[model samples]
Target: MFIEYLTNLLGTVYKVPGTIDPEKSFLELEVDSLSLAELGAQLADDLGIEVAEEDLSSTTTVAELAGLLESRGADIPA
Candidate 1:
Protein backbone atom coordinates (compact mmCIF):
# COMPACT_ATOMS: atom_id res chain seq x y z
CA MET A 1 0.00 0.00 0.00
CA PHE A 2 2.44 2.58 1.22
CA ILE A 3 5.31 1.38 -0.89
CA GLU A 4 3.33 1.86 -4.08
CA TYR A 5 2.42 5.38 -3.07
CA LEU A 6 5.96 6.26 -2.07
CA THR A 7 7.41 4.81 -5.23
CA ASN A 8 5.01 6.70 -7.44
CA LEU A 9 5.59 9.95 -5.60
CA LEU A 10 9.35 9.58 -5.80
CA GLY A 11 9.09 8.78 -9.46
CA THR A 12 7.15 11.97 -10.05
CA VAL A 13 9.67 14.13 -8.21
CA TYR A 14 12.40 13.62 -10.84
CA LYS A 15 15.25 13.74 -8.32
CA VAL A 16 15.37 10.23 -6.95
CA PRO A 17 18.60 8.88 -8.41
CA GLY A 18 18.30 5.11 -8.31
CA THR A 19 16.13 2.11 -7.66
CA ILE A 20 14.18 2.67 -4.52
CA ASP A 21 14.82 0.45 -1.52
CA PRO A 22 12.32 0.29 1.27
CA GLU A 23 15.08 0.02 3.83
CA LYS A 24 16.95 3.00 2.43
CA SER A 25 16.45 6.27 4.25
CA PHE A 26 14.77 9.19 2.57
CA LEU A 27 17.92 11.22 3.15
CA GLU A 28 19.69 8.89 0.77
CA LEU A 29 17.08 9.58 -1.89
CA GLU A 30 17.79 13.31 -1.64
CA VAL A 31 14.20 14.26 -2.35
CA ASP A 32 13.82 18.00 -2.22
CA SER A 33 11.97 19.56 0.71
CA LEU A 34 9.32 20.98 -1.56
CA SER A 35 8.64 17.57 -3.00
CA LEU A 36 8.47 16.03 0.43
CA ALA A 37 5.93 18.63 1.51
CA GLU A 38 3.87 17.97 -1.56
CA LEU A 39 4.16 14.24 -0.97
CA GLY A 40 3.00 14.68 2.60
CA ALA A 41 -0.11 16.43 1.38
CA GLN A 42 -0.74 13.81 -1.25
CA LEU A 43 -0.27 11.05 1.28
CA ALA A 44 -2.81 12.59 3.64
CA ASP A 45 -5.33 13.10 0.89
CA ASP A 46 -4.84 9.70 -0.72
CA LEU A 47 -4.73 7.68 2.48
CA GLY A 48 -7.41 9.69 4.29
CA ILE A 49 -5.07 10.12 7.21
CA GLU A 50 -3.19 12.97 8.78
CA VAL A 51 0.39 12.53 7.68
CA ALA A 52 2.43 15.27 9.29
CA GLU A 53 5.24 16.79 7.27
CA GLU A 54 7.50 16.62 10.31
CA ASP A 55 6.93 12.91 10.65
CA LEU A 56 7.74 12.40 7.03
CA SER A 57 10.89 14.45 7.39
CA SER A 58 12.26 12.46 10.29
CA THR A 59 11.37 9.03 8.94
CA THR A 60 14.34 6.79 8.24
CA THR A 61 13.05 4.39 5.61
CA VAL A 62 10.14 3.59 3.35
CA ALA A 63 9.27 0.61 5.55
CA GLU A 64 9.23 2.79 8.63
CA LEU A 65 6.91 5.15 6.81
CA ALA A 66 4.57 2.30 6.02
CA GLY A 67 4.68 1.34 9.67
CA LEU A 68 3.79 4.90 10.62
CA LEU A 69 0.86 4.92 8.29
CA GLU A 70 -0.33 1.60 9.65
CA SER A 71 -0.08 2.96 13.15
CA ARG A 72 -2.32 5.80 12.09
CA GLY A 73 -5.03 3.36 10.93
CA ALA A 74 -4.03 3.29 7.28
CA ASP A 75 -4.73 -0.48 6.82
CA ILE A 76 -1.51 -1.05 4.92
CA PRO A 77 -1.46 -4.16 2.75
CA ALA A 78 0.82 -7.00 3.67
Candidate 2:
Protein backbone atom coordinates (compact mmCIF):
# COMPACT_ATOMS: atom_id res chain seq x y z
CA MET A 1 0.00 0.00 0.00
CA PHE A 2 2.75 2.35 0.89
CA ILE A 3 4.57 1.47 -2.28
CA GLU A 4 1.53 2.20 -4.38
CA TYR A 5 1.09 5.45 -2.55
CA LEU A 6 4.70 6.30 -3.17
CA THR A 7 4.54 5.45 -6.87
CA ASN A 8 1.64 7.75 -7.30
CA LEU A 9 3.34 10.37 -5.19
CA LEU A 10 6.50 10.16 -7.26
CA GLY A 11 4.70 10.56 -10.57
CA THR A 12 6.70 9.87 -13.75
CA VAL A 13 10.11 10.84 -12.47
CA TYR A 14 11.09 8.03 -10.15
CA LYS A 15 9.99 4.48 -10.17
CA VAL A 16 9.99 3.29 -6.60
CA PRO A 17 11.91 0.05 -7.08
CA GLY A 18 11.61 -1.48 -3.65
CA THR A 19 9.59 -1.63 -0.49
CA ILE A 20 8.43 1.64 1.02
CA ASP A 21 10.98 1.64 3.74
CA PRO A 22 10.78 4.72 5.90
CA GLU A 23 14.53 5.19 5.82
CA LYS A 24 15.12 6.22 2.23
CA SER A 25 15.37 9.67 0.80
CA PHE A 26 13.02 10.68 -2.01
CA LEU A 27 15.81 12.94 -3.21
CA GLU A 28 17.80 9.82 -3.99
CA LEU A 29 15.06 9.03 -6.46
CA GLU A 30 15.29 12.50 -8.01
CA VAL A 31 11.87 13.69 -7.01
CA ASP A 32 12.17 17.45 -7.16
CA SER A 33 10.57 19.95 -4.79
CA LEU A 34 7.72 20.89 -7.14
CA SER A 35 6.85 17.27 -7.59
CA LEU A 36 7.14 16.73 -3.89
CA ALA A 37 4.63 19.47 -3.20
CA GLU A 38 2.23 18.00 -5.70
CA LEU A 39 2.74 14.61 -4.09
CA GLY A 40 2.16 16.03 -0.63
CA ALA A 41 -1.03 17.73 -1.69
CA GLN A 42 -2.26 14.57 -3.30
CA LEU A 43 -1.46 12.63 -0.15
CA ALA A 44 -3.18 15.18 2.03
CA ASP A 45 -6.27 15.20 -0.18
CA ASP A 46 -6.44 11.45 -0.55
CA LEU A 47 -5.99 10.89 3.16
CA GLY A 48 -8.42 13.64 4.04
CA ILE A 49 -5.91 15.44 6.20
CA GLU A 50 -4.15 18.75 6.23
CA VAL A 51 -0.50 18.53 5.27
CA ALA A 52 0.95 21.88 5.99
CA GLU A 53 3.19 23.44 3.37
CA GLU A 54 5.62 24.08 6.21
CA ASP A 55 5.90 20.36 6.70
CA LEU A 56 7.05 19.96 3.12
CA SER A 57 9.57 22.72 3.62
CA SER A 58 10.91 21.00 6.68
CA THR A 59 11.26 17.53 5.16
CA THR A 60 14.08 16.50 2.88
CA THR A 61 13.58 12.77 2.76
CA VAL A 62 10.87 10.19 2.29
CA ALA A 63 11.46 8.83 5.79
CA GLU A 64 11.05 12.25 7.31
CA LEU A 65 7.89 12.80 5.34
CA ALA A 66 6.58 9.46 6.46
CA GLY A 67 7.44 10.33 10.03
CA LEU A 68 5.61 13.59 9.66
CA LEU A 69 2.60 11.80 8.28
CA GLU A 70 2.73 9.30 11.10
CA SER A 71 2.93 12.10 13.60
CA ARG A 72 -0.11 13.60 11.97
CA GLY A 73 -1.97 10.31 12.53
CA ALA A 74 -1.69 8.97 9.01
CA ASP A 75 -1.79 5.19 8.98
CA ILE A 76 1.39 3.90 7.34
CA PRO A 77 0.25 0.90 5.39
CA ALA A 78 2.60 -2.01 5.37
Clashes per candidate, residues 3 or more apart or on different chains = 0, 0
By summed lDDT, the worst window of 10 consecutive residues in model 2 runs over: 12-21
For candidate 1, the per-residue lDDT at 63 reads 80
TM-score of each: 0.75, 0.59
lDDT computed for candidate 1: 0.73
**Candidate No. with top TM-score:** 1
For candidate 1, lDDT tens digit of each residue in 1-78?
Answer: 777767766766645766888887778777667777776787777777887777888346878888888788885433
Q: Can you write out model 2's per-residue Cα lDDT over 1-78, one digit (the tens) per residue?
A: 454455555554445555544455666665567766777777776775677766665235666666666677776443
* Model 2 C-alpha lDDT versus the unseen true structure: 0.61
**Error in Å for residue 27 of model 1:** 1.4
| TM-score: model 2 vs. ground truth | 0.59
Cα displacement (Å) at residue 69, model 2: 1.2
Which run of 10 residues does model 1 get worst, by summed lDDT?
8-17
